[model samples]
Target chain A: MTEEAPAPEPRPAPGLPPGPFAGPAPAAAPRQHLIVVRVRLPAHLRTLVQLEKETERGPGHGTASGPGHGTGSEVTLELDSPGTQSSLLDALETRYPVLIGTIRDPRTRVRRPFIRFFACEEDLSHEPPDSDLPAPVLAGTEPFVILGAMAGG
Target chain B: MSTIRVLVGTRKGAFILNADASRKSWEVNGPFFGGWEIYHVNASPVDPSRLYASQSNGWFGQLVQRSDDGGTTWQPVGNQFPYAGVPGTHQWYDGTPHPWEFARVWHLEPSLSDPDTVYAGVEDAALFRSSDAGTTWEEVSGLRRHDSGSSWQPGAGGMCLHTIVLDPVDPERIYTAISAAGVFRSDDAGTTWKPVNRGLSSESIPAPEAEVGHCVHRIAMHPSRPDVLFMQKHWDVMRTDDCGESWREVSGDLPSDFGFTIDVHAHEPETIYVVPIKSDSEHYPPDGRLRVYRSRTGGDEWEALSDGLPQRDCYVNVLRDAMAVDSLDPCGIYFGTTGGQVYASANAGDSWAPIVRDLPAVLSVEVQTLP
Candidate 1:
C-alpha cells in the first residue's frame, strides 16, 4: 500500500482571514466583568456571618472599633458576570460560606420555605433563580433583601 | 483548680454557664446564636476548648457551629449532610412509605479520644460522623440501611436518632438510639450495625416486642462499664447488661415509668438518673412536682430527689438530651427543664437548685469538667 501522505495542516475556511482570527478562534479568555451587588441580610444571618468574620480575624480583633470595622447587615459582594439570583447567591455564599444552606437548600438549591428574597420592592423568591435581578439591585441602588419570613410564634 | 462549664442549648439560643469546682455561683454567658434553635451543644472530651453546637431554624435549616475557644466565639463549619444513596424510605405516621428527608440534628456526640472526631444524630433518623471536627460529615449508612429500617416510624416528635454512646474501652463499639426505631449497636465502628432492641416492648407498635420499632427516648452508659446501658424508653425504664443483647424493665418504683432523659453518674457507674413525666401525652412531672428519680443501684429502685426541686404546682418536661453529669468529687448532676430553668445538684442528685431561671426553654444540657 502506498504510504499515506503526512496529514496536511487543516486550513481555515475559504473566506476566513489567515491570521489570529482564522479558523475556530482560540477560546477567548472569559471576559472578567466584576459587578458589586448590595445585599441586606436578616439580623440572625448578619450575626452569623459577622461571627464568622470575627473568627477569621482571630482573637483580640473581634470588636476592634474603627473605620472598616463591624460587618453590618448590609454587605457588598463582588460577582462575576450574569448577575441573577443564582449568581448573587453563589457569590454571597462564596464570601460567607456559612450561609450556604441558610438562604437556599444546599441539595435542591430551592429557597428555604421561610426565607424570602426581595429587590426593588418585588418578591423575587419565586422567580427563576437564573433570571436577572432588577436594575436597582444590579446597580447597587436597592439592595437584594433576604428576609426571614415573619414565621413561628 | 477544677471548674465546670455547663453548656445549655435552649429553644432560642445557647448559654454557657461557668462555675467554680463548688458548682455554685454561676456566671452565665450567652444567648449565642440567638433567634435560632440550639438543639445540642457539646464539648470535646479530648479537647475541652473545642465545642460543637447545632444551630438551626425552621426557615434556615441546620448549621453546625464550632468553637475552638469554648463558647467565647464560634465559626460555622460544614452543614452539608448528604445521605449515602437513593436515601430510601421509612414508615410514616400513617404506616405509608415516607421518603427519608433530613430535617435537623438532634444530638451531637463528640469522640471520647479524638478531638476532631464527632457524631451527629439527625432527624429522619440517621447517624453522621465528622472526623475533621465539624468541617465535613459522612453518613454512617449501615444503620439507616438496616434491613428493618423501612419499618421504622416516627414518634410524636419526628423520627430522629437522638442518642449516641461511644464505648470508652472499645473504639470500634458504638451505640445509638432512635425515637421509634429502638436502639442499634455497631461493633465495627459505624461500618455495620444491628438492631439491639431484643427485649424492648412498645405497645404503640403493632409488634410490641419487635426487633425494632421501640421509642427509645434516651440511653446512658458509664465510661467504666460501657456494656451496661440505661435506657429511658417511651413508657418504661430499661437496663441492658450484655451490651443490648437483651433489655429488662427497670421501672420499679418510678411514679410513672414514662420519661424522657436518663443519665449515668460520671464516676459511679451503678448510679443512674431519670426524670419521669406524668405520661407520654402529658409532658410534665407526675403530680405537678418536678422530681428527679435517682437509682443508685442502677434502676428498679428509685428515690425522688426533690430536696431543692419544686414540690408543688411546677410543671416542666426535661428533654431527652437535657441531663448530664460532671466528673467531680461529689459528682455533680445537672438537668434543664422546658420551663426555662437549669437545675444542678452538686451532691449527685441528693438535692437540686436552679443555676439559672427564666431563660428560653432548655433543649439540651452538657457539662465539661475543665482542669
Candidate 2:
C-alpha cells in the first residue's frame, strides 16, 4: 500500500482573514504570571466574608472584625495575568464561595440587578465582564469596589 | 423551670427574645446579620441549641446561618442550593411560562430527630434538605416535579414554598405548603409527593374546586395529632382530619378569614389561632383593629384576642410564617407584624403583649421551649 503524503500545513493568504482550515498560529509568549488585585466589598458582604474567615480561623482569632469595624476591607485576590472583571470575580468567588450568587448570578455570571462594580472613581457596572479593569485596579493601586446600589432601598 | 426563646426574623435582621417561664419580662438580642432580610429562624427540635436562620437581600442573595450555641453565635454554612435536574416552567402572574429559579429561603424546618438534617422551603417554590448540619443542601425535587406543578402560579407574593410541617408520628411523612398551590404530602420521606388539596376551593382560579392552585398561606398541626391539620388560606380557614385527604371550611366566625397566618396551640390539639386581615386588597386588620382569633373547638367559631394588640389605626400585615406557639403550659402564642411588633400571648391568646415593638418589619416568628 502506498502511503499518502501528509497534507501541506495550511497558511493564511496575505491581506485575507484566516480560513477555517488554517494551521494554528505561532505560539506567543506564555502569559502565566499571577496578579494580586484588591477588592472592597460593601458592609453587608464585608461582614459575611469576614465572618466566614473568622469562623475558619476559629473563635477569638478575628472576633474584633465585627460589622462596625470599618466601612470596608480590602480582600486580596490572586488572579492570572491580564485579569479582567470576570477573572477578578472568578477569583473572588473562589476565595469566598459564599459570595457566589451575591455579587452576580450563579448560572449567568451576570452582575445582580442592585449590585454595582466600581474602580478608579468610575462606574464599571455596565462594562462587559471580560473587559479589562482600569489601570489603577489592575495595578493594585485602587481596589475594585462592589457596592449595593443606593436605589435598592 | 423552662425558658421561652422567640426567634424573630424580620425585613432587616434576626432577633432573639428570651423570657422565663412566666413569659412576662423579655430581653431582646439582635439585629444580627443587620441590613439583610431574615425570612425565618428555626431551632431543631432534637437540639434546641442548634438554630438556623435564612438571611437574604435583594442585592446579595441568600445565606443560611447555623448557630450551635443557640442564638448566641452563628456561622455561615453552605448557601449553595442547586435545583435538581432541569427545573421545568411554572405559570407566571400573566399566565405565561416562567422558568423555575431560586430566590430566597422562605422557611427552614429542621429535622425532628436529627439536628443535621434540615429542610428549607424556598421562593420560586422548591424544597431543599441539608443532611450535614447546613454544610450542604440537596433539593427534594419530587414535590416540585409533581404532575400539577406546571399550573402552579404565584399569589400576590412570589411563588414560595413557605410552610413545612413534619409529621411527628410518622418519620416518613412530610407536609409542605406553597403559595397558590395548596398543600403537598410526601409519604416516603420526601422521595415522592401528592397534592393533598382536595376539598379546597379558590374563586380566583378558573376551576374553584381544582385539585391544586389554591393559595394556602400557612398550615399547622399539633404533633400529637399529626393527622389533623389546620390551614390559613388566602381567603378561608380550613381543616383536615384525614391527613389532608379532605378539607372543610372552618372560617365561620372569623371576621374576614382573609389572613396570612394560622397556628395550633402547642398543648391543645383543638385550639387554633388565626389573624384575620381585612381583605386581599387591604392587608391590614378589619375595622382598623388588629385581632387574633382563637377557636377553642377547632373551627366554625373564633374569638378575637386584642387586649395588647392595636385596636385601631393599625395598618400592618402579618406574614404567613410570622405566628408560632411554644410548648409551655398554658401555651404561649407568639406572632410578629409588619408594623415591627412581636406580640406574645402568655395565656393561650386570652391576652397579649409586645416582646419588642420597634424592630424592622417582622417576617417570621418561631419559638423554642427549653428546659
Task: Highest DockQ: give the candidate number.
Answer: 1
Model 2 Cα displacement at A67 (Å)? Answer: 23
lDDT of 2 by residue, B214-306 (tens): 999999999889999999999999999999999999999788989999999888899999999999999899889999999999999888898
lDDT of 1: 0.85
The alpha-carbon lDDT assigned to residue B46 of candidate 2 equals 94
> Chain B alone, model 1: TM-score?
0.99
Show model 1 residue runs off by greater than 4 Å: A1-33, A51-71
**Backbone clash tally for model 1?**
0
Looking at model 2 chain A, which ten-residue stretch has the lowest summed lDDT?
Answer: A16-25
Predicted candidate 2 versus true structure: per-residue lDDT over A1-153, tens digit per residue: 011123322222112211232111123413557766777776678787763333343321222222123222557777776778999899888877878889998888999877777665566788899877666665565667777766321
Candidate 1: tens digits of C-alpha lDDT, residues B6-109: 99999889999999999889999999988788999999988999999999878788999999998898989999989999998999999999999998999999
Write down the lDDT of every candidate, Cα atoms only: 0.85, 0.85
